[model samples]
Target chain A: MSGEGDIKLLGMVVSPFVVRVRMALHMKGVSYEYIEQDLFNKSEILLRSNPVNKKVPVLIHGGKPISESLVIVQYADEVWSGKGASILPADPHERAVARFWAAYVDDKLFPAYIGIMKAATEEARAEKAKEALVGLASLEEAFTQSSKGKPFFAGDSVGYLDLAVGCNLFWLEAIRKMFGVTFFDVGKTPLLAAWAERFAGTEMAREVVPDADSAVVFAKKLQARFGSNTSAK
Target chain B: MSGEGDIKLLGMVVSPFVVRVRMALHMKGVSYEYIEQDLFNKSEILLRSNPVNKKVPVLIHGGKPISESLVIVQYADEVWSGKGASILPADPHERAVARFWAAYVDDKLFPAYIGIMKAATEEARAEKAKEALVGLASLEEAFTQSSKGKPFFAGDSVGYLDLAVGCNLFWLEAIRKMFGVTFFDVGKTPLLAAWAERFAGTEMAREVVPDADSAVVFAKKLQARFGSNTSAK
Candidate 1:
């Protein structure tokens, strides 16, 4: 029977959501073997584990597979509650607020970013880019309130919301480089701009998050395979 | 200085999602003021509480507002952990699995139902209906695995996934009545069909979920305003 020591993660390196799960594992100080699944030819285990989505970032613990990054992250927090700092806040209200913003990152910010890339026309891409900025601006307000001059969204340390949003920083930077659409615009959201810098400089962020160049290259490969609306400036 | 007694809920009676939040509150036996919002002219509290979405159902506790039904439900579970049966399972794996299915209901089944309602063409509506059946079939399989032959998705008592999916049972029944689209098909998904009957008959389900006739009435009102592809059978 598989046990806690037998934890494994199935993921592709470039996916930001996959990166988010990895961050949670890191925060929890849990050791797990990384099984990189080739997206072109998906593994049978990946399909079996997540028959619903067949997507990456499936965490197999004690022979049971848990799918979805946020779900898996929450699972890690629950299972390894005492191993490291809890990913979510101890207070119920605070935890709910954190969850709210984390969801905003997935359901709003990332979609806006993806919308820009997937839009069929430059005008549409520009429109999505504007939405992306608005998303960032909202998060900027959230950061000022939540962080209280702290560097991370979880206050002092990297937490769930931090991983949720911070995982996309490199991708946003890549978008900036490719589309000339800035994410960390200091004039508009100075606190968030600074938060991004501080978050990216964290040791785990350095070790785990893929660089902007890699994200750009991977994105280009994807665009080459499936066309994109905008190209590098 | 507001306290626990200051709980207030801002919601519209017609929304299934809003009912889901109320079910959570009911399950927890948390009494609060129900502030019915005329969505045409949203209240200042609703606007202030949920600046991001500006939608219901917003749960206000001690002057702090939390938006989104699922998020509010989780908050209720956490805050009232000591009271009533815990909404989510104590076991991490169980909790994760429950969350996954709950998300599926929102991200898959509900959308499919909504698609049937909102589709511009009959052809598109039929396609969405087929997808909805496929989603139900998948959930039937999930019910078999997760329930371990128990009645509830949480396995005996009503819990998170039960409420998440069950909140839509009345709406689904209403759809079936209006459009002749069967959800609780006996032959294909006997377990789920049986489970639905059992869940819907539960005291809370009877109390919290709007009756199918009411849902049909609400849906007709919506369609009269917004237009629908499929009319009453």
Candidate 2:
């Protein structure tokens, strides 16, 4: 499977989640065909492969489709272990802790940020934005706890947990612009802010992440039509 | 650490998540203390132990506090490997796949369920209810694909991933009532619906689950103040 070209990823360039799958694959040095899908108008291949979710960041191996970004990242980590990048902790407990926070970021924080973007009044939006900062503050502490004295979320190298949490960094910036707030300030959240910067600068993440300008454009469009972004509605 | 009085879980009986920890403990036949806390007016011990998240379901073993349900479930599985119920697979790839969907249920699906419970409009609420079903349908297929001929989610015995995903079954009925919908029809989502019934009937789950009457009382309070649950706002 390592030498074969049977792996393919269905995703769009702008989705931070899709970028997460791409970054993990790149870090593992696993070659794969990247198929960009128009989410508004789905492709037959994408729909058939991922019939249940009908969403991007689906990894197809020989034909089996795996949806969910974190799932895709885990699949990549397990499939290419010890080849290029070992993206998961060897110790099971440490691995569980890493996974806990990754789920935390996706489960609790992102939706709060989405709420902030949808807030109607300036005062309401500001309050919502402040609340989001509090959530980020908790994440900062969690990162400090998980990373301890290491460079990445899991340990010495970027791993499953790091990739799972790292994808949300782009969304953090997007919400900051959307609500005129800056929650990821280094002074306030040094550990997590540094982690985000490090992840974005990584060769794998750099190759996959949408450029800052494009991200800003995406965020503004989402903000302008915040009410309609099914995610929040 | 496995000796008597060595492992203690600090939490109340009211929280489903804390019950998740308790269920895992019972499944593994691990002995532990059940400490109660007033979440609205949290105890100092709870705050210090889980300073990062300030949440319940904290597991203390050999003088260390491990917060988060999934992490604690994994810890329980690791410590009580062969006592009774063995959660989590030995094979790395199967373990990875299990962990992936467990994360999916907690991260993506549960939030959508929460949204449906909190929605202000009937249409918006119905839409979120559908989203929750979409998520459940994905889980249904994952169960079908992985379970194959088995009766459980991760095969013979209830695994960590099963505990992780199964923990939410009790809440589905209550949450569905809040949105005036039943997204998980036993007839429609046969695999998942049957899985939920099987998981719910377990002795551990049966003992901890709040009765239908209590669930109605709890959910009604949430409905009364649906717009004020500021966790997402």
Candidate 3:
């Protein structure tokens, strides 16, 4: 698995999920072909590669397609054990904690973000925005629980947990602009804000992340679509 | 952690998630005080233990509360390593695959089940039922990709994955009974069906799991409440 190193990734450049996989690869110093996807009309390769999920951030290493962003991150970490970055902690307890937080962010916090972005009315938007704020607050607490004054989510060095949770920061900023609200209070969640700033300023994030302006523009289009939709009513 | 030997679980007998933690502990051979909760009037311990989530299946080991069902399962597996059941696989790749499917079931498939159970209209009910079938179908495909010739999700032995995905089977049955439809075509998904039977019949499952009759009865009560609201409308 390690020697046959012709790695390829299929995903859109704009997706935060795609950026997650990109950041993992960048951190691990893995060379991979980045193929941009038109999600509206999915390519045959993307479809065939990920028949189950049929979503972006599919990693193909030596002809094996690994769907799911976090799963792909684990695969990258496994493949580049000694050569590059170690995304997972060696200790099982620490690794479990990292994974638990990662799952928590994806499962709980992410829905709030989605709800805020898709709310129909200003009232609904505000309600969802408030919930998102609470979720982010819990995440801030998790940062305090695990980091214990460390720089990253897992510890001093960036790991899988950071990439999984950190990928959503761009989406968070876009949602705030779209919904006309700010959930992240930098003063209150100083540690998390610092972590976000540090992770976002990394070479991987800077190189692979969608620009803030473009993300906001994309979010605005989604918001407009939700507004015009009869279903939203 | 093992030497402490003073673990207690606060939860109800009815919740599948509570059963998840119970199964993990049973499999791990971890001894604990099982305190049944009154969901209507929650105990102070339940509230104090899980302040953030304020939910059941809270594992208090060594007087520390670990909230969230899956998190508790992971904690049990880690803490009680020398116990009877090893919930998670030692191999990282196998563990990742197990976790991936478990998350898929929790996030995607279970929501479809909830939608079907809660649908007010016959048309909406049928549509949601169809979605649940599709979710199961995707799981069937995921099994084909990974499970292949394996007996359990993680080979011969039942692990964390079986417990996670298996907990949903009773809910599917309950939902199907409420809607007067069959979701899991035993003839179609033989392996999944067999696996479900295996999991349900396990001593751990038998001890903790409530009968499908009870779940259907509870679901019907909820549906009736909703139906009354619709009639008022």
Best by TM-score: 1
Relative to the real complex, the DockQ score for model 1 comes to: 0.92
User: Could you estimate the TM-score for every candidate?
Assistant: 0.97, 0.78, 0.86
- Give me the runs in candidate 1 sitting further than 4 Å from their true place: A1-3, B1-3
User: Which is the leading candidate under lDDT?
Assistant: 1
Query: Against the unseen true structure, what C-alpha lDDT does each candidate score?
Result: 0.88, 0.74, 0.75
lDDT of 3 by residue, A156-193 (tens): 87787888888888887766555556656887777777
Candidate 1 vs candidate 3: the TM-score winner is 1
Clashes in each model (backbone N, CA, C under 3 Å)?
0, 2, 2
**Position A13, candidate 2: lDDT:** 79
Candidate 2 has a DockQ of 0.37
Q: Cα miss at B97, model 3 (Å)? A: 3.0
Which 10 successive residues of model 1 chain A have the least lDDT summed?
Answer: A1-10
What's the candidate order when arranged by decreasing TM-score?
A: 1, 3, 2
Report the CAPRI category for model 3. acceptable
For residues B52-157, could you state the per-residue lDDT of candidate 3 as single tens digits? 6678888787676677777778777766676676787776556667767877878777787777766667787778778877877777766665665787776777
- Which pairs clash in the backbone of model 2? B87-B159, B88-B160
lDDT of 1 by residue, A116-202 (tens): 777888899889999999999999989987887888888999888999999999899888898888888889999989889998999
Q: Give the per-residue Cα lDDT of candidate 3 at A70.
A: 80
